[model samples]
Target chain A: MATELPSNIKSSDVLTDQTSSKWLPPGLALQKVDERIMTLNVGPQHPGSGHMRLIVQIDGDYIVACDPDPGYVHRGEEKMAEYRNYITNIPHLERPVIHDSCNVLYPYVLGVEELLGIEVPERAKYVRVIASELNRCIYIMYWLAIYGIFLGHSTMFMWPAGDRELLIDLMEKMTGARVTHAHFVPGGVRNDLPPNFEEVCLRQVAYFEKRIKEYAAVFYDNPILIARTQDTGVLSRQDAIRLGTTGSVLRASGVDYDLRQKEPYDVYEELDIHSNVMKEGDSYARSKIPWLDMMESCNIIRQALQKMPKSGSVRVKLKPNPKGKGLNTVYKRVESGRGSLGCYIVSDGKPEPYRVKLSVPSFRNLIALPYLLKGEKLGNMPSVYWSLNYWPVEADR
Target chain B: MIGTATGIIRALNSGIKHLAIKRFTLRYPEEKLKFVGDGYQFDPSTGVGIAGLKGRHLLFHDHCTGCQLCSIACEGVAEAIAMVKVPEEHKQNKKAIMPQIDYGKCVFCGLCVDACPFYALYMTNDYELSSFSKEGLIYTPAQLQVKPYVAQDSEIIITSRGATHG
Candidate 1:
């Protein structure tokens, strides 16, 4: 992902030859000697764009290029790791995608295990897969709920969130924390699923299936959406790979590259990963990608549950020492809701990691905006952006 | 060509049916929407009425710690929250405290309610709170404490604020 340029690039570099020099202008004409059109700064605080800011270069009504303004939501996560203990970093990493905390941080914990050469028990791996996939569902549902808000579809926002309450309740019972599940330490998960976990999960799955169909009936097959999204913001296969994209964004462009299926992490190798690929590469494809992935996530959780392995310990139960674990660094990438959520830890083999960098999918998908927006109309910009499912907290981190 | 015609005709039929389904919009004020049981639970604390329901400032002044954390969480352009200290010598263990909310400045993001640690706030469903004076708008801790006698949120006290949340 790091091809060129420094680790730190100044904000002044975001401005291009196309900043309008005016806020209200609609279009710009091009000529050999013409000045670049004006650029608009939309949020660290603005509607449509959530949490982080966007630096958009507009040539008249169309966007010439759009660059993400990261750091408002940075939270100094990498910097914070320098001082915090390994256990302490769990809380901080959880904050990045709090809803998918287990998925984002579980791999980091597993990496620490790899360095220490500690084997996570069988029962714990089964439970971790369930929790992580369920976390993916939680985040994808949240994206759908919020995307409905972006599309001005109020009922869509309310329906998914209301049903999501059941899943949240189930997760809350197991982990204690409603949103942040700081379970899954170096050796294993916090504990086994409580009684009636299977029954409740089955019910939620059934409820989700019905809701998924409803979501499809409302948006998937909706006429107004077809006109707005079909063939809009199309990206070819080559550009997608060259740009370092993954998950649904990569799969939507016919890459067939899923870490769960290809890399075979966890129980995913034993189970068949069902993926629905589309080569259209349009905004509609991007919008529909989450729906496909959500169902796939459900399938993964179901398999992880069915093939429950016999167990040992949940945690490796390390002896505490002020001296720490010592220096060892490991980088682990896991498929998460937004994209490839990679966690890199440089441990001094101490109690705390020397440095931690989270490579979130939102951060990469965010850069894909300018390429998509170049020739699209201003009125259609919101629709294109919503289709991208950009979350500020994940991107900024 | 024949298949495309059937698809268009079916599309038109569904479109008309959808419009008919949505045409049954309730007048809302005259005939309200209903919520099922446990009915509603109105703690003397949390003044927040239900999302679309009607009720005015339900507050808990006795338990308030006056941390001003609510002001920090309010997502708005204005700083509706202000703090004034009672001073050290004035008394109960010489403590210093201040948490004053200016409604004129309050955008009502309910962050204060969430931030209060002690759940001392709520945005009751009272939608009819139109103020003629700027003074009427700035509700102090005292004014925000009690609910109206008539409940002021619904018709005939049949579906009063307390009944829904009780």
Candidate 2:
């Protein structure tokens, strides 16, 4: 249906000055007209916003423009890495996205190993895959929980948050920490798995898979959510690629690009990974893809556990204060929970790195926010925004 | 109207089903998690630290040589470990300087445990180190020597209904 403007309305009338005469000079008189539009700053302190603000301009119920203002939680992680030595940087480097610490540190570990010319053991690769997949579900559950509350579904928030502990419990048993595992390192993982880890992991993950399937009835397939989200902030295939969006935002628009399948890292090439894609490219599709990916993650974890060698070392013995080859640089990218997280390192043959740069997916995916939000209803702001899977701290860092 | 009604009912049904399921939260302070090993320890022979939670640092006064390796290792990371002058006299610790860890700044990454060539520094499962004062949190060399008492027996049990940490 085409929206036709009233014949009596003129283009200049829509842009009429509304300032009072007291605020302007005597010679310049302000026009008196009824105000139909208002600006809303939803941000920084709002529960719906994750440390960033959205400058929204709404005309009646429709939003005219939405500008995403980021960089509220920036701590300059890349700058801090230059001062610390290779081994010491791990703890602080994973702080940007603590819940998804393994994946955030994956590309950094890969790049550092490349610079040091260390070959990881076969068992370590399989262990890394399991840990990465587990961390993926943990991070996604947290995101989904917030996505639920943003859409006024309180039960959706509670269930995902509760079930996420199953994965976090397994992570704690395996890597020692609940969220910030700091498990991945330059040569390999920090330590080997605990005894009877396989059985415990298998049991918890199987239950977790069962729990996530129940979300389909409650959150994903609900008619109210579909009405509020579907066709509201639609992004076509051309715009998604043209805007340089990554992860679920890109995949929701019928793009079948998943870095795990395309540029396979570690044991990803050995394992079978099915990239979840949807053609709708609305808020619903963006939200549904992550749930599909969580199921795929469970499948990948089961495959990794069955194929993993029974007994072997998880960490390679690295010399104290290990340094890279002189004046060399390396860039590595890994498929993280948010999207493709890449790390670029330039080593100067010293213990400390020369420079480090992170190409975070949250910042990349945020580019499409303003594009999708324009001309959308004001009520659909939270549904459209949170569905993009934007992590503020990671993006700002 | 039928589709909407069923959708709401289905969602409510899922929520109601979980009400019969047990809670997954661990009642902390009263109940701590049981770890697999005693603590995270490094063997010089293997050159790899064993798998465990990186918690409070436990210093072995007898094994410490006042080497300052752990303090040096923590410089770029947390700067929580400091080499301070000690009054006691020992053959190994000739310098009379021992490492004092301030828990305020520690990230508990356990890099210091890996840096100790001698089996002097290791991590224990005692994570409950909360204190009233800032000075109380700074564990001295003598304080680190004493082992912490921790009682943890909780584990996640999966049942026909659901999973719970008990």
Candidate 3:
């Protein structure tokens, strides 16, 4: 779907008045001096804001206008990708979403494999699917943990953080390293499953599922959290579609669109993936969608584990410094923890790509922030903002 | 009012029930978490790496051919592995050079290990690479040859009460 910014609110420059003093910020000045509109910067350093600034203009606790200032953590990831070959780009590209590195690297690996003309084995495909689902759960847990602390729920923070260790332990045994597991490669994964990994994964995942179900009592069903987030920052189904929101945010608004269900990259078609949707479009719905997705992820992982081939090669033997076939462009996207993470590569028959572009979901979902925040009370900002499942580092990258 | 009260009570009950559960935190130094294997190793013949903890780099002087493939691989990624000329004379190693890794820059992605066709390099489960000085962080080929002793036994034991590092 093609989406464009409403011309009325194209830029912060349009919001400024000619009568404003040079020293004042863009959104501060108004035509009428007595309007009592005050501008508040949530932060590049504020507790609620994560590495990005929000320029919020408010009047008597009601927000008049909001602007999200991202790019504090931008490291020119795309530009750096052009310098490195396809294989070396694995470690660097996965940095944006360290928590879901496998999912982030999934599209890049898929795209590279297409360009280099390498066939991934059936076992590798199954392993990739399992790893991806596991990573999705890990990411959603982290997000849920943060969503808890953001809503002044301490127990919510501790439980998910602790419960997440089960999967992280599994990931370490599978890929190595806790957060930035550069496990996914072009031809296939960097390695195969460890000895006796299936039994351990199944045992831990079953336990992990039970643990998360307990969260309903403590975090999700809590009256205080429900009161704070429900009916606050409601995004309509039409608005969600118009804004081109992806992942949980889109699903929260009654759009039954998930890249896994719709696109079915890799072995997703073989596995039974349930795309959860909520009709309500509030902060509560947005927050609840990821938890539901985590449940679905657990199911997907179980099915993938069952379907995987017992014994086969997980990686293809590629020629050293493998170059692209010819001057060609390939775009591949997969449903990541945040949203649909797309990788676009332009290769000119070189080991190093001519261009690499990552269409990150965080950046796309960010467009809804100003739309959702406007006309809402200032106090509900953290709940609404954090509920979007926006990761600042990925957006900035 | 009843719904709200029940919700609050339910949350409180969940919190109280967790008090009996064993502590999840592991006391580091005193108690180190054990890894599954020695380290991450790659088989050049199979073109696949064995899954293990990616920690510090280990060097085998006997296996190193001084081909500089590992160094060349690391150049695009981290430039952590440097081919340094060593004084030791070996029959296989003509130039007496091996990968001297600066752990400070190493992301521990294990690409260099993957690049080593002769199996000269592999990652070990010795991640405690903290040093006071910057010079100490760089492991020479000789320093990498000595395998560090790891005393780790703790594993995550999930029980009915709750999971804990035991």
Candidate 4:
């Protein structure tokens, strides 16, 4: 929703004559006013909208009508899938949600493997679950990190990224690359752990638990953050679904539709998911969901570590004729850090995929912004939007 | 009912508190932060990629086994990485593996790494590959080979520990 609309929009609450009610476009139920006001266009470049620009017609600071403009960074990602081979897309797709690379690419690999009928090994499943949960922690860490600034809890923002680096180091040890870990493949993973991975992982998990409390001390305890986020931008369960909000936002709204619970991918089914259901769908609840989710992510990682087989092939043996038996195509949708990352892959009896289309999560969630921001003050915009953690690249991709 | 003075005071108090507390900013050039282990690899002049560092294309020399299989398996997108075999001297028994990287046209995909049986080449994180002249990007065998691998003093540990250093 990164539309850079012009500031030429008439701001006044679209004041109508005393006699009749004419057509006023879909923003607010046109506010009853007398004089016309100047409409201010906030972002494609503005701070509040992140990467999105809203055509916000405002009277003073209160918004009259808001329209979100999108497709600024659309690099034809789905179209690129048609051109790229099956495995090559792991890197291409990973770039969008760079923080949550494993989660984004998990379903893509799952979808492709399901199509090729290549059963990914058990050790690989454990690896995938661990990697995905670690990615979630990193992503949520950034979410709280930046949102901390919006709420004026500066340390919360910095602390999470610094701590998240520990997990990033762990990922680096597992897969050679840090952010873009090309660990997930059609059959299984690229390689196995480089020894002492289990010990290092447990230590980082405990360290994260210690660091997450500092988040409470800095941000949660601070009254400014509490005031700004607690009840601001509230969405009831019905409103949230109608707005198509998912992930922490939906969890905040108390809908509790975590894909980890619903369509349990990898080792998620075996591990008990901790759903942080906040009755209040406010920014505070939304912000808190990820912190709690971070703990759950650690728990899942621990469960995965315990559940992992003693010694087996991390990567399934690469068959000479990979596209053997049949070339059945299937689409698999799994929840990523952003939201639902679904891959629709088609195979046509060749080594290369006939077509691949990725239904990214951020793009879906970006549409929910204008609905939430109807009557809210301009000041609370950064806090609300920051909590959303809209990866513009992921949305535009 | 929020006053302008109150807002300003709150903001000022917060800013002062942040400064009073441990300043999170790294003072990047002056007081550098310690890089945990290995930072993303790179060189100044030539942007040659190392292992798994998704560069535009890979270039292999006399070490390449004459299996043009890499180019053959390159699907959908035209084979950006080509294994052109030019047999110079068979004295050492390995064929002259002359690899050309057309940076003008390459996706920087490490497919060749996955494809190569010999594990002859890989990608590094040197992605500052901008050039005024187009000719600089068209990498030759000697250009790509790890002979005089532009050895750098990254000032990593030194820069971070410099203030404390004697």
- Name the best candidate (by lDDT): 3
Model 4 lDDT per residue over A1-397, tens place: 1222235546454454544344334553444443665566666773522366667666677665667776666776677766666766666777667778888888888887777667777887888888888888888887777777666766665667666667776776666566777667788776666566797688767666765764564566556667777777777889888878778778888887888889988777888777778888888887787888888888888888888997776665555335623556788888777667788878887766777777776666666777767778877777767666577777777
- The full ranking of all candidates by lDDT, starting with the best, is 3, 2, 4, 1
Candidate 1 lDDT over A358-394, as tens digits, reads 8888778766777888888766777777677677776
A67-127 in candidate 2: lDDT tens per residue? 7888888899999999999999999899999889999999999999999999999899999
Q: Best candidate, DockQ-wise?
A: 3
Which residue pairs in model 3 clash with each other? none
Model 4 misplaced regions, further than 4 Å: A1-37, A46-50, A319-327, B1-63, B71-97, B101-109, B122-139, B147-166
What interface-residue Cα RMSD does candidate 1 give after superposition?
A: 13.3
Ten contiguous residues with the weakest lDDT in model 3 chain B: B21-30
What's the distance in Å from true for residue A63, model 4? 1.8
lDDT, candidate 3, A125-168, per-residue tens: 99999889899999999988888888888888888888898999
List, for all models, the DockQ compared with the true complex. Answer: 0.03, 0.70, 0.87, 0.14
Cα error, residue A369 of model 4, in Å, equals: 1.9
True contacts kept of each: 0.00, 0.73, 0.87, 0.07
The DockQ score of candidate 3 comes to 0.87
Worst 10 residues of 4 chain B by lDDT: B157-166
Query: What are the RMSDs of all candidates, in order?
Result: 11.5, 6.0, 4.7, 8.0
Model 2 chain B lowest lDDT segment of ten: B40-49
